[model samples]
Target chain A: MSQTDIASRLGWVAVDWGTSNLRLWAMDADDGILARAESDLGLNKINDGGFETVLRDLVAGWLPDTLSDDNSISVIVCGMAGAKQGWCEAPYATVPARPETLAAGAVKPVLKQAGLDVHILPGLCQVDDPDVMRGEETQLVGFMADHPDFAGWVCLPGTHSKWARIANGTISGFRTYMSGEVFALLSQQSILRHSMQGADDAAAFENAIRHISVKPKELLHCLFGIRAGGLVSPDGQQAGAGAAILSGYVIGSEIADIMARLGRDESIALIGAGKLASLYRQALHVHDFDAEIIDAESATLGGLRRAHAALTKS
Target chain B: MSQTDIASRLGWVAVDWGTSNLRLWAMDADDGILARAESDLGLNKINDGGFETVLRDLVAGWLPDTLSDDNSISVIVCGMAGAKQGWCEAPYATVPARPETLAAGAVKPVLKQAGLDVHILPGLCQVDDPDVMRGEETQLVGFMADHPDFAGWVCLPGTHSKWARIANGTISGFRTYMSGEVFALLSQQSILRHSMQGADDAAAFENAIRHISVKPKELLHCLFGIRAGGLVSPDGQQAGAGAAILSGYVIGSEIADIMARLGRDESIALIGAGKLASLYRQALHVHDFDAEIIDAESATLGGLRRAHAALTKS
Candidate 1:
């Protein structure tokens, strides 16, 4: 279909606007994705009051040329785009709360564009332990949509990985680990960078996970060991062993901590895609906890659809 | 005195050249300081074969104009300047060995300057555990010089902090923690940076230390708490509380691990100066361990003097 045809068929828009990027999906009346678009202009890059302009420009092709209230498209946004510094602040809805009811807490941002009707979803917050999540709440909503009675933990691995507890169709609480960011900084910026130049080694990764699992307190010591290992026997180790060990040590530490708190009796719903998901799955296996990988994109879209349905009804 | 007068009185030079900076102390026959100099031209900045020129330029004023073998000055160097990529490779002296005997493993680099006899002190390494320390071994020697029979732990805090076991006049083993570096990366480079601004709070620091001590496995979770605490109660927290909490958490985790591995029955000799030393001392006190602060400069100079005396005798 041409741009006009897709625009005529578009019933609404879905956006996952995060810290570093923006993703959009054009949905038809039946909730089918008619078209999709994305940009690097995430929350971090936009200036004050520039969000609407950026969004309008990005979705202009998906909107009908004729301007009227009846033709205005509903744009549902999730993630940091609803943060205080985002396009317009959508205050956090405190838990324990059902993800489907999050639409009640959503805020509508007034737009200068005539054909765009935007609703930003509220993130979740836990006051007692002091924790928060934006984008992952929608992912949880999507996961719950498929498995309405699912319980236990959901692990979303990323720069700041989130591990959430779900029971009775509501998120009880969650914890965020800076493990992914820490890994990047250690591998690319720290002294360990020198030792981490080789390709990935599965054996080295698994061994490091086991090592950290047995002695989790020696994390800092283990990090320095990567550098010292290369120094002591410069020619003895296999290529890429350092990188693999560093990755294993970081992810292993995160998993180890979670296991220590929750135990490894129940399997985890690992909600992510690509290499990060696979790595978390492998790391989870090291702890003898089976992980079922779920597609992140599908969850995000399903979440937007659920929220959109709730918005239309109310 | 004039430059020439100081140069004439100079008996030898003691150097501590680390990865990021260089420090030199000119000494008389009695090991009394004649003059001192420093440069930002550390090991990281100097290219291969350029160490000689940088050192010569920094210490040119401290050396006599007339060059002769009779007036040859012995330059005792320690730290990363003696690493594999340094001016000369001073191979590591394995532990379970006295720091005083480190001079035996010192490597002499062939230099272009005729009046300078340079000996780079060897670092300490542990093969089994895979750990290494360059300049710190000299500091250990210095501490030993002052308290020859003192048997306890010596904590040298820095970007990479070292905690060593001292018994039988030998360093049995040591562990290095990258706590300081991790703190820097998180407070200045990570998402926590935004919430870390404000004055230092002692109470907040101590409270965070106690919090981490109770739930050590929740370290990664505690890190993200710093950010969430700011987000949830943005107006309630004291200025600089986030920074204090972050500092407390990172250092507390390191100290907690040490306490877990080795009980807190013995007092520790803390060898460092400035804010970092005081911070570590405070953190150590929180664990009910008394810390005796020893000036880092005094220890480095004393260690170099011990090494120099040994070199002259040999």
Candidate 2:
């Protein structure tokens, strides 16, 4: 749709702002995307109290020139934009919280922009267990909306990977792993960087998966082995192959931990996209666990749409 | 000892050249230390073909101004200086190798200095398993000399912690864990740095050790918990406490791996000094394994002494 058409038809805005980037979508009343925009100015990059300006700049083309008083467009945001360190603090809805409860937890940030109803949905927090997740709760709500009876585990793989338990349409508990960050540190910043060149070897990955799964205690030893392996290998073990093995060791450790917690046979709802999702999926398969893949972007939009509908109805 | 006094009495030299620093000891014939010198010029800092000059500069004060043609001082070096990438390549002494045979594996590089006999001792390498250790082999030889009948595990904790199997007065097998490096990276470079301020919390360290030792597979999960814990804790947790916990998890994992390999009952000859050694000793105690503490410095000197004797006699 053209910019004019998008502005005229826009019912609400959906945002998934995170640590590294901001993604915004303009949606019509029918839950169809009228326009889309994004920026690399994630929470970490923006100055203090710059969220409103950043948001306005990115979505300026999608906004109508003027609106009748009280005829404001609803703007719903999920993720770090609602975090304590983001635009404004949106207190977390502690689990066990239902998908329907996310809208109630949403806080409307008072913005300088007139004729714009902005709501930032709160993330989920578990006090006694000491775990907090932002942005992911929206995805969970959307996942539950689709599979209302998914009384099992949901895995969202990312920089700080989260694994949440859904029981009777409510989140009971969850855990996070620093697998992605650890992988980056080892491959790009640590001494292991010398031995790896981002090569992807399927065989090396599979072997590491099998080995680490059986002996997770040997993780650090196995990590050093990668350097030793590369140093000793006649051809230096193709960098891609070395990287694949490193990823396997990292992602494999995460899989092993989750399986140890939630058991091996239970199927998981894998919510991720691109290379990360594929890796998680492969890791799940290696452990003989069935995984139902869900595109993270779609889940985010569906989640925001669900929240938006609930707010309008209320 | 005064410099002049040490130079007059100096019989030979012992040098431990590693990745981060260089330590040279002027020793009398009986292995009595006459004087010592050190430089930050480790393998990683010196330019290509600069090891000879760097060495000579550090120990120049001890070298006699006018020596007879055959009155050169014997300078024995160990550690990364012998690695493939270090000063001069000293091929590994593949196991099962005896302590008395290290001198045979030592390589002499012709240097510009006239009155310096330099012998670089080779590290140990396991071809089939792809493991390598440079300087620690010297420490191992020294450790064996102090306790010739000791046959069990010897752990040298540092950047790349090592666990070797000692039997029949020789190194049968060994393994290295990147625990120290991982700890440094996570506590200083990774996101966990925010939560860990390099604090030394005894309680936190002990608690994490006990917990991780029982369920080592929970390491990644526990690591994420550190971040979550800091985020949720009203005080953000004492940086020291967080760092101590991080250290515990890393070292505890290493202990768990070594215990798994060697069986929990066998005692370990812990060859380390100061903070790292104490940490490992504490971890070993927590795991209910007896650890006989050995001074790392003495072990290095002893190993070099043993090698020098073997070379001169042969």
Strongest candidate by DockQ:
2
TM-score for candidate 1: 0.95
DockQ of each: 0.71, 0.77
Candidate 1 lDDT over residue span A152-235, tens digit each: 889999999999888788888889999988998888888888888888788899988898887777888888889888887777
DockQ, model 2, C-alpha based = 0.77
Which candidate leads in lDDT? Answer: 1
Q: After superposition, how far is residue B138 of candidate 2 from its true place, in Å?
A: 0.5
| Tens digits of lDDT, candidate 2, A40-63 | 999999898798889888888888
Q: What's the lDDT for all of these models?
A: 0.88, 0.86
lDDT of 1 by residue, B45-142 (tens): 99979999988888888888886666688999999988988999988989887966699999889987688889999999988878899999999999
Candidate 1: the clashing residue pairs are A198-A240, B198-B240
TM-score of chain A of 1: 0.96
* Reference contacts preserved by each model: 0.59, 0.81
- TM-score of the second chain for every model: 0.96, 0.93
